[model samples]
Target: MKIYSYPSHVKQDIKEFIEKRLDSGTFGLLVQGDEDTIEDVKDLMFDQDDVTGNGSGSYTFNTLKAEECLVGNWDLLREAKEELQPNVDLIEKGPEFCDVMIRCYLLDWCFNKALAEIVNNTETVQKGDN
Candidate 1:
């Protein structure tokens, strides 16, 4: 899930794995800065909106969005794990991809200390026409 580059799995392939069940798609990748160093860091946008178990959702653009959502709706960030179950076989499952899935969810949240949406360099385009 490196920033400004394409995602690991294809968009549609992973979409079906969680479509209508979970929000999953590499809509775009972002490069946000580290508040401490002012240096650009890689980030990604795995889901269009908050990984609401349902299809539709709103972008996280408020203060303490993650914390508030965690307290108010545990499923907000939790359902991501349950949703990605099939992506990995239960037999060979570990904490790797699941961690990516979670980070993908958390990265899109704005005003969360490190949220930047500037397109500096694009390695690939994830659109219909290039």
Candidate 2:
């Protein structure tokens, strides 16, 4: 299958923020919304490992952000910026990615994407209501 590679325009800090989270081991970005009846709280936990499992009734990009789900973690967004100070990790590797100032804006999008398709065929999903 095709993997989701970072767009060439993606800034280095954003890449590092996402990649750092990827390296942080198994984590799921719990996305919640109102669908079906809009009264029921629909919850779908997108595992970093499960993003690769875009098959069947399991998690797909369509389901991740679909259902008009307004999902995002304010703390993660803040931490992403604070946790990794001064983008040194990427610089040490070499000339890191350079581009526009879209990093902060796309941090939430990185949860399911960017981290998707990196792993092979994984087909399990965790969905619930809360």
Candidate 3:
């Protein structure tokens, strides 16, 4: 598996967050946002609104907005997570932690999508040369 690295601060914050969750037995914590936020995430992942359909009504998905959303959300969550302290109430810090987890998952999706695109394009170009 490829090793993913974060900035020192983000890496430290994630380590502490995981330790706190384990210590508090909060492993079941759910990360969720409002419906509008959910829709925004979908749009960021798929560019849902920009999709087009062929004459036979089969839709083509072209854009991937994951990298853009991931970068922005990661920065925001990093700032919020950095403000957390060991003494801070878990209730107060839960939302920020959830945001960080959610963004991390999104970043994983973005990285996978980018990799798939690179592979697919390379295959297409190779086939064209035949």
Tell me how many residue pairs clash in candidate 3.
Answer: 0
Task: Please give, for residues 44-130, the per-residue lDDT of candidate 3 as tens digits.
Answer: 433211221112222222112222223445454454345533354535534433333433434434433433444466578879999
Displacement of residue 129 (Cα, Å) in model 3 is 3.3
* TM-score for candidate 3, residues paired by index: 0.25
lDDT of 2 by residue, 37-66 (tens): 111111121222232111222222353332
| Candidate 1 clashing pairs, residues 3+ apart or interchain | none
**Least accurate 10 contiguous residues by lDDT in model 1:** 1-10
Q: Model 1: residues >4 Å from true position, as ranges?
A: 1-77, 82-91, 110-113, 116-130
Error of 2 at 89 (Å): 30
For each of the candidates, the C-alpha root-mean-square deviation to the true structure, in angstroms, is: 15.5, 16.5, 19.3
TM-score of each: 0.24, 0.22, 0.25
Better of 1 and 3 by TM-score: 3
Worst 10 residues of 3 by lDDT: 47-56
* Pairs clashing within candidate 2: none
- What ranking of all candidate models by TM-score puts the best one first? 3, 1, 2
What C-alpha lDDT values do all the predictions have?
0.33, 0.29, 0.36
* Candidate 2 lDDT score at position 27: 24
Order of models, best lDDT first: 3, 1, 2
